[model samples]
Target: MRTDRIFGLAVVLGALAYIASAFQLQTSFLSDPVGSRTFPIIVGSVAAVCGLVMVVSPDPEPDWPHGRTWARLGIAVLVLVGYAYALRPWGFVLPTALAAGIISYQINPRPMAAALTGIGLSVGLYLLFKYALGLGLMALPRDFPG
Candidate 1:
């Protein structure tokens, strides 16, 4: 089978599992209208749709990435994993900024631009999540001094 078909099938299966698991999440009586399962279901649905698109309309000749590109992809994955681990200890802003900066630099190879991009993204996302979405995310670590 084509690589895209295989990847799309895997994504579709994973998304189905994710949606199913989301359905199993228990919610309190006082939970909001949008329950815990809502977001996960939405995400899974989106993923499944995208996977279906890829499966149905894959590129005739996908240009697979070469050596350096593969290495960069690996680094990006590592950065994302590190970001997840650092969230509890470092809080949202710092680790997010660092990860965004690293990925931006990898994409553009411009230090100053990447730094600014990271700062902008972290602050913007923080404000959007905290204020607009009314989500309570830590700006800094609990032990972090003002």
Candidate 2:
């Protein structure tokens, strides 16, 4: 009943369920060659492999966090959850910037540096996803940017 063993069990079970769900996914008329299930299958396989590896050779003595670290962790989790909820409405760039800046500030306590880092990451990733990947992510709404 070790920590790693529990983690491995969870990983394996989650991956198995995910892969099974992938099989139920309907194929699109104009989808990629491998179809939609490819990513899920690949992800599940990787998770299964990692779970097995962990079960066989778990971390000897994991460093558990304490004190302020727990508070920071809680804040970080809340920030991420907020980011997820706001992603579609606020759009990727703003949420990314906010989350990144908050995390940066949480780590080092520099507001200006955090804001700049957030802006840079948001703008950079927006262009990358839009241009390089040809993904259609929503930018700021027409009225809001101006």
Candidate 3:
């Protein structure tokens, strides 16, 4: 009934459930060669392995995060929520760039570099999804360029 063992077991169970749910994803005829299930399966497998290890090597004492860590985590959650909310109205490029830049700035206090990184990631991911992956992501809003 150790904490580490319980946590590990929970992780393992959660991973198994995730894998099971991922298997239910229906794929179209023109899906990728690896299919949609591949990534989830890989992620779940890794989680399961880690969980098993944690269960075997359970830690009696764990270091809990302090105030700063908690604050950062809270900020991150807020930023994510804001990003999701903004995505529809502002479109992919603007919201994504802003989120990335803000998060990067939170980690490292370099505003310019963070902004550039955000812009680069936004554009790069947009192009990649649109061209290479054949996925349609909203890059701009309908009433843009006004």
Q: What tens-digit string does per-residue lDDT give for candidate 1 at 89-144?
A: 89889999999999998898899999999999999999999999999899899999
lDDT of 3 by residue, 33-113 (tens): 899999999999999999999999987757768898788778888999999899898889999998998888778879899
Worst 10 residues of 1 by lDDT: 54-63
Candidate 3: worst-modelled 10 consecutive residues by lDDT: 57-66
Q: What is the lDDT of candidate 2?
A: 0.89
Off by over 4 Å in 2: 1-62, 142-145
For each candidate in turn, the TM-score is: 0.58, 0.55, 0.56
In candidate 2, the residue pairs with backbone N, CA or C atoms under 3 Å apart (3 or more residues apart, or in different chains) clash, namely none
Ranking of candidates on TM-score, top first: 1, 3, 2
Candidates' C-alpha lDDT: 0.93, 0.89, 0.90
Of 1 and 3, the candidate ranking higher by TM-score: 1
Error of 2 at 69 (Å): 1.0
Off by over 4 Å in 3: 1-61
lDDT over C-alpha atoms for residue 25 of model 2? 97
